[model samples]
Target: MNELTPDVFDALIGQDFVVTNDDGAKITMSLTAVSRFETGAPATDIDGNPLRAVGFQLTLRGPAQPLLATQAYPVDIPGIGVHHLLMSAFEAGRTAVNYDIVFA
Candidate 1:
């Protein structure tokens, strides 16, 4: 699998990703937004070299029904391989629920 970066997902906004529920059912979620930021602190590599602290967040919208519990789920991103991403439901409306995946 390729490294997941903000740029990698930036172009994928508005695309649908399939999440396999615990019951073996597929739930479709649309990639609503991608937020990117930089941490104030500098990061260091394994070799102790300084690196920039960058991170990103992905917001996905799915149906309100079958509200998924906060946990890691297998999400299939088209063109990209399937990845187990930690998702948390942050908002809900009458018809849709929003999930967030943060990478830092």
Candidate 2:
């Protein structure tokens, strides 16, 4: 199981307000604006250099979509929690990009 420690969990929550569904699906509510502080350094290309433009993506394991805001999961899975999301960062006048997986 990919378990996230408290520190790691805190990092994502600090980045944005996350809304998740019972089926293990989640989305970053503040997607319109990236967090200047929580988001890490700029991303780099394959050559290991910095690049321009920065953003992140939220991912799910299954085909099932997330529940509506009004809906709720019937039960919470013990032990296994926190879904994975792709986080990307970049800067201008560069060719490198950085990416990471955040949990919610």
Candidate 3:
């Protein structure tokens, strides 16, 4: 569960996602979040078929609450500047789960 660098996440950035800075405030990406993104296609087994990897799409949801809530919201963090942004496959609900995003 290692933290990914901006370069790594930048590779995944495209036209499907957005990232904003907390007003240029420093922040760290949660390990759990990173882990989810790092999972990718598995190696080929003896069966001769490549293992299927978990697929996922990442959407930047913001206006984060002071505490965790059970519902989901689409908002931006007020006063935050542009830190980093990313978007995966826009074709339907497909996104690469093999990349992690790291922000500062």
Model 3 TM-score relative to the real fold:
0.20
TM-score of candidate 2 versus the correct structure, residues matched by position: 0.20
TM agreement with the true structure for every prediction: 0.88, 0.20, 0.20
lDDT of 3: 0.32
Give candidate 3 misplaced runs (Cα > 4 Å): 1-22, 33-54, 57-83, 86-104
Candidate that would win on lDDT: 1
> Which lDDT tens digits does candidate 3 get at residues 1-104?
11334334435443233332335433222112222343455665588765434333333322232222232322222233243334221122222222232222
User: What's the CA RMSD for each of the models?
Assistant: 2.1, 15.6, 13.8
Residues 11-96, candidate 1: write the lDDT tens digits: 89999999999999999999999998886655786889765588789999999989999999999997997999999999999999
lDDT of 2: 0.34
Residue 55 of model 2 has an lDDT of 28
Q: At residue 36, give the lDDT of candidate 3.
A: 31
Model 2 residue 39 CA deviation (Å) reads 31
Scanning candidate 2 in windows of ten residues, the lowest lDDT window is 58-67
